[model samples]
Target: MDYRNESSDTLRNKCAACYRQFNKKEHLVEHMRTSYHSVHEPMCGVCKKHCRSFESLREHLIGPLPKAECERIFKERGCDICLSILGNRTSLRAHRESCLSRPNNNGLLYRMANLGIQDELRIDNSRGRVVALACKMVGGGSDGSLDLCARVCLIDEHERILFHSYIKPNIPVTNYRYEMTGIRPEYLRDAMPLKNVSRKIQEFLCNGEPIWQIRSKGGRSRILVGHGLDHDLKCLEMDYPAIKMRDTAKYPPLMKTSKLSNSLKYLTRAYLGYDIQSGVQDPYEDCVATMKLYMRMKLSQFHKKENYPLATDPQNKNNFASWRQNELERMTPDQLLDISRSDYYCWCLDSQDY
Candidate 1:
């Protein structure tokens, strides 16, 4: 009788997020309510098992006592960086090659192209310009605790510099942090004024469309890619529509195992397999690193539609409604996961055509 009861318990429904088994489907739903499971949580591509951290996911894949079948499949198709399971070995090879390439700045350097009419830009084939931005800050205020933007750089998808300039700070700079920034007082002496630089970047990002229209998809406004864009834009005294921004630091897949923002330097080395910001940080180098990361994510070919939550769709309600409790309890574990909705938007969605 005890053996029979144990076997019945093995058949219980499990919450994918917390991996808690329940006797009933409704009980599993209740567990999810407080589990706070989200798309940001690291998930196994094979079994769709969600883990609390990338470390847990890594263990589930290759650590001791891994799931037998999942470990078998992941060994064949998993990506070490993004942890995505590709369709085949060929796809995995191609994906890994792109995912772990060293950063390169082969794009055209700063120059006045076509007598400066080209605006120092190399445009990609995208509907609007997709640019990566980076900024270097010198400290200001008492005890050198404040950030004052001293240098800014923008690069296109091809890693070509669109704009690079030192800014004359509105306030006095107390610490240049020369070892890291390589910025000296002389660099800002004849630099462009903050207002002019801000206006130029604002106009360039909007691309002649009204600022209000930037929120709309596929509009003329440029897509801004960078790490920590909130702070960068804040320092620049500029505003951009949130939807148009692709911030690496905030993107879920690139986050640390603990769900915190990863440093750009660490992300570059881990994903791109190269060091950056090791010496005096160059804004151009930072821009290139971010652009590579953005392109890698933007071009991801992972299957996402089934797990994506179209929250606006009235028909896409949660699967655990009371009326369907019996039906859900009878479904397999994989089916339960199929009906589960991701709590955050996946970046791979950006590759989809509207």
Candidate 2:
């Protein structure tokens, strides 16, 4: 994807979504801010405008979001009041408590532990849900426990998979009671072979989108998937996406517990009712678990009429919601994974973006 000297006639630096560009990177970024702003972050409700800068986003949402969506963001940022709609959960709560508008400080909604993600999020209110294109996870050994090894897996909307296996512990190698468990040092015997591991992942991601770019849409067009993908991606030393990822572990309702486990075994049992590994996990098996979980969640959403709140209200076509969704079922896994991003408006994560 080099934009080098091919031909001045074809030299174009258009934004992928809007087909706009500029001579400099700074201008390009600024252009994205206005054109893709609705998808990147969010627009102010009352003013019907979008955040012009980081500071402006903060000044905007200091008021309120539905109690539901507000709760989800609060959990990620450690229950802090957040002004900018783009930040994590903790910051939102901070704003809710400080802004005169924060609902009742009812301890019911403010549970310290509940500060992870909300059970129900504001649908269609923001594009964040529709844009999540992939998943990530950190596997803690193969036998459903963490004694042996930890590797992170990345899966995107197009069914692409990448894994970065851990090698030596940052902490000095030491033998603890759980030492020789599932992936015990005695069992593993040698280091993770980092170079070899890197090569395998490089090949897998050879044709897919990077995690950060996948999340930029803040909705379903792109999907980065995995159980508890956040921790593993963060640990892998990758740039964070402002949107577009499908982390089963932290997804609403299911996220009350682990950050998508990075553990497919645990996730499959909890969400899909199937066990993933007898010993070490098979990458294919892990991919299936994540896919099933995603499908399950999506199917459930389809049943809720409100999930497609924006769909040209079947009851009244005059007032249209601008999106349509019908399950693509009885199809092969490959078929499901191959879906295009244009259908991003179909996901039911929330009721707004569609």
Best of the candidates, lDDT = 1
TM-score of each: 0.80, 0.34
* Residue-by-residue lDDT tens digits, candidate 2, 270-309: 4454465554333334555666666545543332233223
101-164: candidate 1 lDDT, tens digit per residue: 7756432233112111124642333434688899889999988879999888887887766788
- Runs of candidate 2 with Cα error greater than 4 angstroms are 1-171, 175-181, 184-215, 218-222, 255-267, 276-287, 303-353
Clash count list over all predictions: 0, 55
| Model 1, residue 222: C-alpha shift (Å) | 1.9
lDDT of candidates 1 onward, in order:
0.74, 0.37
Candidate 1 off by > 4 Å: 1-3, 16-20, 31-48, 51-56, 62-79, 82-99, 105-128, 257-259, 306-308, 312-332
